[model samples]
Target: MELFGTEGYVNVSVKKICDEAGLTQRYFYESFPDRVNLLAAVYQHCVDIARSATIAAATEVIDRAGVADGPVPAAVIPILAEEALGGFINSLVEDPRRARVILIEVVGVAPEIEKLRLGAIHDWADLIAGFASNGRPTTPKQKLAAIGLVGAITQLLVDWQMALTDPINEQAGPDLFQVDSVHEVVTEMFVATYDKIFG
Candidate 1:
C-alpha cells in the first residue's frame, strides 16, 4: 500500500518492499511471485479496509441522522464518500511517492490494475442503489431506480477526482448526495434520477 501509493507500479520494486519489510529477497519471492502480484495484494488490502470503513461510517451516520427511509440517509452518504475518498487521500496526502504509485503509475497500464481501482467504486454503487431502494428491489422500476442512484454516487467520485485537490465530501459537496433525508445534491441526483427512471 505504501509504496504502491507512493511510487506507483512502474517505480516500485520488490527489493524495496522486501527491504522495507526487513526480509530477504528469498522471502519476498516466497510470498509473491512478482511485483505486480505484491502490488495487487496491497491494493486489495487497502481497498478492503476502506470499504469496511465506508460501510461502518455510513451506518453510524444514518443512525446519528435518525434517517430510516425516504431517500437514503444524507449523513451516511457523505460518510461513505468520505471513507472512500479519505482512504486514497490519506495515502497520497502530501506524499508524492504514494501519488505516483497508486494514482499515476498503474492506471490504464493493465486491466487487472483497473479492476482493483474500480472495485470499491462498484461496491459503493451497490450501496447507493440499496439506499435508494431500501433493499433489493422486487420490481424493474425499483431496480432501475437503484441503479440510477448508484450511478450518481459513482459519478460523484469521478468528478471528485477531476477536482484534483478537494476531499470527496468537500469536492462532492456537503449536499452532493443529500435528498429527502440526504443533505447532498449528488444524493438528490440519485433521488431525481431514480424517480425519473421509474416514472
Candidate 2:
C-alpha cells in the first residue's frame, strides 16, 4: 500500500516491489511462489504489526487504568478496531495504489491472496471471540459476530473508494493516519452488542 495504493493490483509486478525492497528476483521467487503469495505475506506482516501494536496499546491502557492482575477485560474488539483503522489509513498513506490492489485486485484472479486475507480476518475474529469477557455466550456466536464486523469494516473501505467521485481521489490527510476511525466507530457497536446480551 505504501508504494502503489489500491491500483497496485494491475501491473504491480513482484519485480517492482522487490526492486524497491532492495532484493533480487531470485530471492523474491524463493520467498514467494507468486505475486499472490507475496501479497498474502504482505497482508500477514502488516496485520501482525497492527496486532502487536494493539496488544501493546491495550496493555498500556489496562495498566494505566490500574488493572494489571485481574482477569483481563474483553479487549479484542478495541484491538481489532485500532488495527482496521490503521490498516486502512496507513495503506492509503503508504501507497495510494495499494488500496486498489488490496481491496480490489487481490480478490480477483488471486485465490491465494483471498485465502490469506480472509483467513487473516477469520483469525482475528477467532481471537476476538475467544477472548470475550468471562461467562460469555458460546464461542460460535462471538466468532460469527466478529466475522461479520470485520467484513463490515472491510467493506467500508471499499465503500469509501466508491464514494470518491473523482478521477484521482488521492488527498487523504494525516488525521486518519493516527487512528482507524472506521474501526473506532464499529467497535462501539460490537461492544454494545456484547454488553446487551452478556452484561
Among the numbered candidates, top lDDT falls to 2
For candidate 2, write residues 1-199 as lDDT tens digits. 5544533545678778888889999998888788767666666666666556545655665566456666445554455445444544565445445455445556655766667778877876665554454434555666677788668766766655544423223444333322356556666765775665333
Q: Which residue runs does candidate 2 get wrong by more than 4 Å?
A: 1-7, 18-24, 72-105, 135-138, 161-184
Q: What are the per-residue Cα lDDT tens digits for candidate 1 across 1-199? A: 6766644567757788888788999998888888877767766665555555546655665666677554454435545544433443344334444444444455575677788766645565566556545564536665555555545544444443334544455646434432222325554554455455532
| Cand. 2 Cα-lDDT | 0.58
Give the lDDT of residue 51 in candidate 2: 56
Q: TM-scores across all candidates?
A: 0.59, 0.67
